[model samples]
Target: MNPTRSTFGLIFFTKKANENGECRIYSRITINGKSVDLSTKRIVDKILWNSAKGMARGTSKESLEVNDYLEQFRSGVVDAYQEAIIQQKPLTPENIRNAFLGQDEAAHPFQDLFNYHNEHEKQVLAKGTMKNYYTTQDYILQFLKKSKKPAEWDISQLSYKFIADFELFLRTFKKKDDPQPLNNNGVMKHLERFKKMINMAVTIEWLDKDPFVKHKLKFNSKERGYLSEEELALVETKELKTDKLMYVRDLFLFGCYTGLSYIDAINLTANNLMIGIDKEHWLITQRQKSAKPVKLPLLPVAAELITKHRHDPRAISNGTIFRPISNQKLNDYLKDLARECGIDKNFSFHLARHTFATTVTLANGVPIETVSKMLGHTKISTTQIYAKVVERKVSEDMQALRSKLSRKTVPDGEMIILK
Candidate 1:
């Protein structure tokens, strides 16, 4: 088959030199200035590569083998192009690349990306994180159905418009139980997970270009809500009307006292408790999300809750000190409990950790570094966010300021009159 092409193919080294002092080899197929790149999944030494010849230099075994592979790669592109012409397909770089990879007849389902990531990162990612990914994939399926897009799309089919549409869908979509649609940061989070899987596809040579390269993720900076000491005390002391509300309140309180996230709280078992250096019972465990070690001395209130729930049949069955209800249901119960306790703000279980960081720990003279460790944060800067927002200007401090303002000191040159 005779076809006009700009260049048969160009074998090149990736721009980023390897930290191990090697460079990965890649190929660019161009047809009439339209091009697509395919990673060779091969490498050569940085010092031995000859950029001008697009081959490894010298008579060494590695150089000879690399050069031979380059020749085969160039021929492969030509053969792929010929096959496409015989199949009566237009001569485009993407068409040739798909033919070369034998992927022309097959395409990766965008849905399968979730499975691909789960299979590879199951050990590295937390189960809660994997669950979130599953939700994102489900949302993507819903997005496709709503937009009347095909279930199957080529990796190259992902585009800026697709991302924008997904964002809009997330904004307008509401969960079955919730009255509100996804918040701004919630939309950004789903998109972030989606981008992560896309990046993996690019890494494995499934896609040539990143669709999100031009897309900007804009997450709103909002103050994280937390219960104050009085509010926490109110929730703790107020007798709930029902067991359902009591269970959720206990779980929320446990999280508040321990700085344990919802996932971490559910994963806590009898083994997570240990006697610390102070000879007091401590909740010794690791943060599930970050896997950072945590050793916190159980406060009296936290210890009391553990003892109160120690004989809980469900807790025993689940092999944990406490078992919370489902996340959505838990948040719903918290909303009801907030109103029952005469608190104005709607509460979520996650805000329990925020309360722990700000009101329970930092407000009560707990050092920030120690709080960071208990929260399983890796950086001091991350913990500092809680510090900046804590309601430290209490009534007493305000009263003291008022007293100082009342006692006006007259300047040497002028007398100030009280209004």
Candidate 2:
């Protein structure tokens, strides 16, 4: 539509003529007064070219061939311009040139888009999150190689079938370093990352249709395990031989009271401690994982641990409340601490956060809404996973009601009614 508004012509750049006096050919494309010159990779004698007709002057054999090529090139550019308009792509001279050269901007490769999304997300996402995306990317590359597909595939090639096949690959594929395949939720995470990258492509107009539109992500909800109150108390009071075990125990107990994850716990600083509305010292900081603000009032045990480490040389130098330890070392020491304390459960640093949410907060009658807010959860449903009511708490509550009822009830003459 509106043919005169856009123009295409073949031109010879005689100013850059070679020593043999041959001028290079170029295709000029103009759209809405913006223009781009694309090389035709052809050369012609300037004397034989017609500036007015934008072609060769003579009908000689060489001239005929050059003229035919120019006609075809011009027609191709016109077709590319019309096709771009039909596809609702941006009407620019560079885009038309790209279309003419068979390089459509919409056809971005999946790997390229995935890398770009990860690079930009690093600013906002935590290190652990960025590592997860890297793992997902590696898995995708391995999947492509095993499936005998190209390393780089067009994003448009993604489909529901492609997603299903990827999930199957993740479930069945075994790595050389780790023979165990990914479980259901592990596979789901990679697929979710893939879908997110595709969604970004759609937002940037690189994809016309979302392949994940028909695919539904399903994940199994497994109960998150946390240390019970008795086990946590056992760990807290258990004396250990080495100073390292003692340090790990202190870190674990602090998490049990504050509900801070491993990363947040290590990064905590004196600056994060502030007086809240209750006139109590609180840990006010943003969670590394979700970047949500958390306002947790420091319980006695957590505050005591902070005070104990306040004058530590490493803590003082780092300006953090606790000296940072390697996560692997922390977990390893936690295992030792757990066994020495006679707790049979598989122990990890994250369990301490679960303990805080379940045994320390929710079990003590803290409202779920308040727990969710202090845990820095964007949704209450996330808090519910950690706040599951343990059977002991239920029994204790029901036993209290039983005792109260038995004390208030009286035996009547005909019926033993309670008041």
Candidate 3:
């Protein structure tokens, strides 16, 4: 017996038509020709529903509303069919209908899938990534609470419209101590994480249809900021009066040379360094972000910094090259350091990774594939963002072309044709 085989239809209950000539629409679910009728509780005009197409016929508001309800009803029925098979229940039309209608005690329409992810996926996911997921969950709770409709946030009531509303809410939501709401990419990230959790539900047969299926995540392209070669040298060599400022500057410079994010850089222990294929020193660690293995030969400057701190009491005691520091405090010191050095941009600690990809590597003619590996990127496309922003690379290419075409200069306003 093919338990997966099933058919569904919609019909207008003309006999239940009210005085206004509007009839109730009912769902007909069939399993091996054994059928069951369930009331949809949606009223529509007598002639609006197209029985053959299993949908409403026209563009009127009532017809559109009826069509949306019918689609959700069908999705729930599909969910019911999967649930029935999973629990080894008898594959009867009535059993499926009961599950769809919440008459089955086993069916849970609003299972907390976000909570499920935290409990299960946390084991495999990095601690930093798990923290981001928790942030997404908190934002979702805020969205649901602000909706003020008890029924609206339920799993069964979710639709494309609901997704749109949630995105809007995230964009405009400003929590305490936050000066502004989430920017475009910030909003997209929350939705992307939420989509992953929703996918878990679909896999477990909790949701038959994904609301995010029709939604495409769009992140606006912004040119990443990186320090120039001169700026990096200035920051690296600057003498700070305070030990804390000096400490933050060195940590930031280490990231610039190695392309490790803030978390990966601080968590690095002495064991991460090893002899490479060339029999020279290399940094060997997996990126906490992508969990990709990073095996990059140490640059001279990076190796020098490691040697400079090799004998520090804190480094020896902690077994880490650099002890952990608060990200906020580091960024705070970095702002002062950048001002003192007369170099300016958004001087956050994470800017060091961008600096490594641009001025320290690509601008110096390093291969992009090699740079991608050093950075522990899963995709080369991510590293290409840095390459595009390297204006020096574009200028160098143009300069090489200028040298090749040195024979003659085109006269002013003279038209040149390609042969």
Candidate 4:
């Protein structure tokens, strides 16, 4: 009694007849003693059906045509079952029905699944992520049109060739909004979105195999720049003329201490601040981007900034721990601040996050694992990216080793020589 052993046959519903006294035909699939019925969309009069034979009583033209159609439908169902067996797919009635109806993911159109995935994900994904998914969809549509392919593609057609061609199109094709084509990582993001939809198809058994199995997504790692301690000190000490610039600077420094992104920083409230196990002030909040919890003990500088803003009328009225500022204006003021402070680098709010990871934490003797937790990183590997930027730490480590070796009477007995 192997569960995969399936039996299928065509049957007519003689009890349920229409006004014309015709009963609808159905195909029944049985697997592991379980059964399911699928409509064949064909009908015949009760008098013409032969229950024992499981077909219409035949001889006349109409009867012969009905019998022939039934035979063909039965053959298709049997073929589907045989194919499932050959492929070693789970032999389920629903799977067989999908196969017989040509609705298995291999025969199913890609657009349908893509749309379904997008619609389902809208409830759970962040707004920015949903925008990326939409953009990826648009890119796919554009590729199909440029290649003169059909609006609908079968799930089976999502081969390595298809992925390669789509990636090439993304690299070379220019959209109306921008003249430059997508960079490597940007292209990979779209492919990743496409892969997500395909995975969903596989999860539901709509697709028998993953087309992206052999295709590996490649990304170029760009240098993530952050302000050094000296540069940060300069920015902190600089006196700016405008109140707006001062406000932006304070907010930027707050991020540098807490490693919060602009969205997370602006969304913070008094409720998010809590006493930790050490009875010290802590920012206990969830990251807006990934909704992961972040528990960071407030450093002296970060605490001072929070106290400065605690009594601000705007913050009190807005019910936010800090007064809100648009990200664009913040970045614009950071650029001006960089020039005024003599820091020669592109300055943005996100750089504050990078600075926190490198200068504020790692270089200051904090473990990367602890820094990752404070930063609300779901993976330590993400925090490792910042670890690479701690060249000062590397130098200090080597220098400390050199100092220890120099102090040691390395064996007043033996002299070492370089190769």
Ranking of predictions according to TM-score? 1, 3, 2, 4
For candidate 3, the per-residue lDDT at 400 reads 90
| Per-residue C-alpha lDDT of model 2 across residues 1-419, encoded as one tens digit per residue | 45546554434333367788898776677776656556676889888877777788888988999989888888888898789877878777767776777765445676788778988899999887888888888888888888888876666556678888988999999988999988889889888988887888866656545779889889999888898877877887887899999999999999898888999989988899999999999999999888899998999999999999978999989889898798988999888888899888878988887888898888888888998998899999999987887777889899899767766774433344569
Q: Estimate each model's TM-score.
A: 0.85, 0.73, 0.73, 0.72
What is candidate 3's lDDT per residue for 28-51, written digit by digit as tens?
Answer: 667777565556667787778676
TM-score for candidate 1, residues paired by index: 0.85
Better of 1 and 2 by lDDT: 1
TM-score of 4: 0.72
Residue 32, candidate 3: C-alpha displacement in angstroms: 22
| Cα-lDDT of candidate 1 | 0.82
Give the TM-score comparing model 3 with the true structure, all chains together: 0.73
**Stretches > 4 Å off in candidate 3:** 1-111, 151-153, 408-419
Ranking by lDDT: 4, 1, 2, 3
Give the alpha carbon lDDT tens digit for every residue of 1-419 in model 4.
Answer: 24344455445444478888989776666776656656667888888988787787869887899889888988888898888888888777667777877664335676788778878998888776888888898888888888888887666545679889998998999867989988899999999999998899876656545779999989888888898888899899998999888988999999999999998898889999999999999999999778899999999999999999978999999899888787878899999988888889999988999999999999989988999999899999999875454789989999899767966956665666779
- TM-score of model 2 (CA atoms): 0.73
Q: How far is candidate 2 from the true structure (C-alpha RMSD, Å)?
A: 14.6
lDDT of 1 at 229: 77
lDDT score for residue 331 of model 3: 88
